[model samples]
Target: MNTKIDFSHLGDRVVYVKPVAVADLPQEVQAQAEGLDELFAVHNADGVQLALVADRRMAFLLARQHDMSPMTVH
Candidate 1:
């Protein structure tokens, strides 16, 4: 079963930062997560995941590193 959904309507050249669950992450990452549930995900305007980091600040830092301005998706 295909599990991808589209978000092209949100436009382009933008990044969204949102919280993520450790359980939803990979096993290796979960191991490194150290019982952390405060992870964040940085995604493009199209909803393609870019970076997954350990906090709100890191999410924005990741986006800036990629030459993008991060917006908190609350």
Candidate 2:
């Protein structure tokens, strides 16, 4: 049985980012995040904000971030 459901039609707010470990990320995202980690030192700031790509569209803006890369993970 295919458990995958198409939620694309839902409003943009439907997809939300919950707190999860970097290891728990989907393999593809985990890999990409790993690579990004090597190149960027993710940081947290009170006012700094960045736009992240989501579902072929710029869907979300995040604040108070931290590094998820291997170098920073430790």
Candidate 3:
């Protein structure tokens, strides 16, 4: 299985989408989870979080809207 991905065209406009447990987040963020067990976090290459969205699809959509390439993190 060749899973090679070329991200050269994206340059620095790349973001990561990963699932986050509500319980692992701060109280303030957890409160905003709306009773959901999980959420998706969008982060930059430097490991800085850019946004916390309600779902994985939304996280990817956000990145694309901003002209960024979104990669899923396990």
The lDDT, on a scale of 0 to 1, for candidate 3 is 0.95
The C-alpha local distance difference test score for the whole of candidate 2 amounts to 0.33
- Writing each residue's lDDT as its tens digit, candidate 1 over 1-74 gives 98995555545657999999898888899999977977999987689988888899988887788777788898
Candidate 1 clashing pairs, residues 3+ apart or interchain: none
TM-score of each: 0.72, 0.24, 0.90
RMSD of model 1 against the true structure: 7.2
Per-candidate count of clashing residue pairs (backbone under 3 Å): 0, 0, 0
lDDT on C-alpha atoms for all candidate structures:
0.83, 0.33, 0.95
Q: Write the per-residue lDDT of candidate 2 for residues 1-74, one digit (tens) a residue.
A: 97996655542323332233545555776676644422222222221223333321222232222221111123
Model 3: per-residue Cα lDDT over 11-53, one tens digit each: 8998999999999999999998999999999999999999999
Span of ten consecutive residues with least summed lDDT in model 1: 5-14
Top-scoring candidate (lDDT): 3
Q: Which pairs of residues collide in candidate 3?
A: none
Best-to-worst order by TM-score is 3, 1, 2
